[model samples]
Target: MGALLRGLVGLILSSVLVTSALAATAPVGGYTVVKAYPHDTAAFTEGLFYRDGFIFESTGLKGRSFIRKWNLETGVSEQERIVDSRYFGEGVVDWKNRLYALTWTDEIGIIYDIDSFERIGEFSYPGEGWALTRDDKRIMMSDGTSFIRFLDPETLKETGRIEVTDHGVPVRNLNELEWVKGELLANVWQTTRIARIDIKTGNVVGWIELAGLLKDAGVTGTQDDVLNGIAYDAVSDRLFVTGKLWPKLYEIKLAPAN
Candidate 1:
């Protein structure tokens, strides 16, 4: 069943403080909040994306895992489907009108019909699943490591992988993902940094340092409640970010670091 000992796993993985020297050489930047939207404080958001005027999210935790469709105007989830209790839900993404979701230790991936939220199929993978994002043809997955695995959308099987490196050092703890422009943006777990990576070369091209964002928005949280979610609206050119258990989501624009 791929049961994981939460405590032991936490102790090993929660020390996500490793920072590569390569990150020090990359261009860093900050954010400018264009708008703030209400967010469910109870959501431990693991995956996020925008589509058809709605925000789709995947929330984690063993018993509380769920995939929900959110109203950006109201910040309330209009519909949700719970994950099986045995799984700790992780990242989610949409491809060809179908939604794909991953579970942390269960090695399981669930596929659902976007309109009906009906479970249609399942696939398995080795190791853990941290987050998912897609371009036009393929799905990219992160497994809490330096590498991003590429999967064939048709077969949902691994096609290739690229190890993210800053300068030359491997950068780990990549979590939530989003594809913006032509680069892959990855949220480095437990930190306020988002690495903009070159997909083909796996080079960390730049970094978005988002420190003090929650405080600027007056949202409070402990160590575990961290910056973890990111979504983008390609049509409107809007970028959104939020955190685990955060009470607000911010639509932001990137401001190059001075």
Candidate 2:
């Protein structure tokens, strides 16, 4: 059921598409697993990020959508909340102690108190919301398109847009995002690649490829098991990644692609 919705939404998103060939403008990199943690395999991870000592993730697919607050060590949700059935939930991020969650197709975003997970407010946007992340001054959102929208935290209104490209060609299907170091890392939906984008120039500076992490973790499944989530822990400087219905979440150290 969830997989079917995923396929339909994917078709809709891919109707107007861009060729994802990075060519030579970006260098492809690899990874070495630093550590592994448990993740709920049932989660259709659409957004993920690390805050304080926990992982905050949002899952999609109509009635199954959720905002999970996970304890990093045990890979367990210490607290959880279900999104309204009408909305398919997407990305999630934290700003000034507020947790912001986006719903796909519905164009609505929900806000909650970071500590208590209490709903504080909701806002509407113009299109499909796929993923979200943040920089110091603004909230960054992806809408299953090539452009990344910047929203002012207080106003929740779009301030600007960055057309993510690789050598001038638009890169579509920019899924779950994270502000890692100073770069915006975006998942190329249903692929084993992450685009390291330069927000200033809107160019992909590099591509991080993890071809076999799923297989090595014994996460064999259909295309639904693709690489689709990323979360960076700044304080610990650790990078964590997972996928849809994947049992293991990996903390990986970046290395050159072999």
Candidate 3:
């Protein structure tokens, strides 16, 4: 009888330890806004990236979709390409001196010359294009689902994919992706939190909470105004974030949450 009781206790302790370990590995990180920059309030920002002191952004809206290169300091578009009025633009990324821009619901992506903003080529995919980013070898794409697809940058052909999860549960509505260091940082639609995902495993290793970032920046808007853009400057190690229809952009530093 005593042996049976000891075995039961041991099982319970092991279960508890496993649960605690999982919780410890999945941390919710906080952010401190280091600076605020002017962003075009009329722009419904869908994708953003930093390169060579310029911010390349994609805006979405049926007739207003555009790919723009903005001066980081002044928020002025140095070059812009307005897409066809019938197509809605989505996410964008820079690879091999070319800018790739996706179109929502159209299943088409356009590639442009980074310097001249001229259309060089375009590719067709299967589903909606919600977000885009790239690593050293492959381009990462999302379609408002839990899955992230890997594509060959040269061919724009899907090479592989993985379903993203948080603590073994699927994470949907993944949007606005940026490759930071080695991890893929994705904005969760309709929420202020960004998921830090493992590109190889598709597991969310951590969450960056931007809960009060907009409010602290004195941004006022309706519920439709959700956080949606992420840009990282690898050279400076600076992180920038903004939202749909947001008036300001913020440069933030992440810290471990208590």
Candidate 4:
């Protein structure tokens, strides 16, 4: 009887913890979602970057990999280039006057000139590529795991890596990335929450539950179509969000959850 009682108590405690984690919510200090729509529905949007009012996007899938740019205002592809069918394009970032891109499961990252999307060279990685983002100094990458790797932009070498953790647990499946202010904004795949992560310690400072944001937009459905894309426009201080195969991208200003 004692053993059974202990097991039941443990289950009850676990349920409480799960509910608490989901209940801990905070107001977004200063975030406004940018309402923007892409001209085309990208099949697999692996990586996204912005420069000079144009978006540099990388799409996945072995035979359908590509790097392209779209006009921000018109949402029209101004230029596009294709990669070989053997590799899947992943995250993309800007380093100096060049653009760096990664490939899924290929362990190779491609580099190109920023002005012209031309493959200048390639570099090797230790794991599969998932997403890429950068700040003023280091290049940050995710590999579909709990860890985020930092690389040297000039050398493309693993300088160091930080494992993302929620409380004391590893947070896996971190996908699609954007560097906002000094923090790394990560889209936790398959969930309606985006974690604001501190890059130095892998600690999740806070999480923004996007359920209200989506429901407000009338995209009601299951959690399968939850949050995915994250992009920040520093110029206007606007945050843009969307999901996989989503018909429209919304620009929203997050009102703090009081």
The candidate that achieves the highest TM-score relative to the unseen native structure: 1
The sequence of per-residue lDDT tens digits that candidate 1 reaches over residues 124-230 is 99999999999998999999999999999988999999999987788899999999999999999978889999999999898998876868656554466789899
Give per-residue lDDT, candidate 4, residue 93: 87
In candidate 1, which residue ranges exceed 4 Å CA deviation?
A: 1-24, 219-222
RMSD of each: 9.1, 9.2, 5.0, 3.5
Per-prediction TM-score to the true structure, in the order listed: 0.90, 0.89, 0.88, 0.83
Model 4: lDDT equals: 0.78
TM-score of model 2 (CA atoms): 0.89
Q: What's the lDDT for residue 185 in model 3?
A: 94
Q: Highest lDDT: which candidate?
A: 1
User: 169, model 4: CA deviation in Å?
Assistant: 2.0
Error of 3 at 116 (Å): 1.0
Candidate 4 residues 1-258, lDDT tens each?
999999999999999998776565433343455465753455366777677787777777778888888776677788887887889888888888988888988889888887788888999987789889999889999998999999887898899999998775678999989999898989887777777898889988777777655664455536445556677788987777776555556666765643
Clashing pairs in 4: 33-251, 33-252, 34-251, 35-251
Using lDDT, rank the candidates from best to worst: 1, 3, 2, 4
List residue ranges in candidate 3 displaced over 4 A.
1-25, 219-222
lDDT agreement with native, every candidate: 0.91, 0.89, 0.90, 0.78
* lDDT (10s digit) by residue, model 3, range 1-258: 999999999999999877865565467899888998989887889999998999999999999989989988898889999988988999999997899999999999999999988999999999899999998899999999999999999899999999988777788999999999899999999888899998789989999988787776566434657899999999999999999888789999999864
lDDT of 4 at 191: 75
Model 2 score (lDDT): 0.89
Please report, as a residue range, the 10-residue window in candidate 1 with the lowest summed lDDT: 14-23
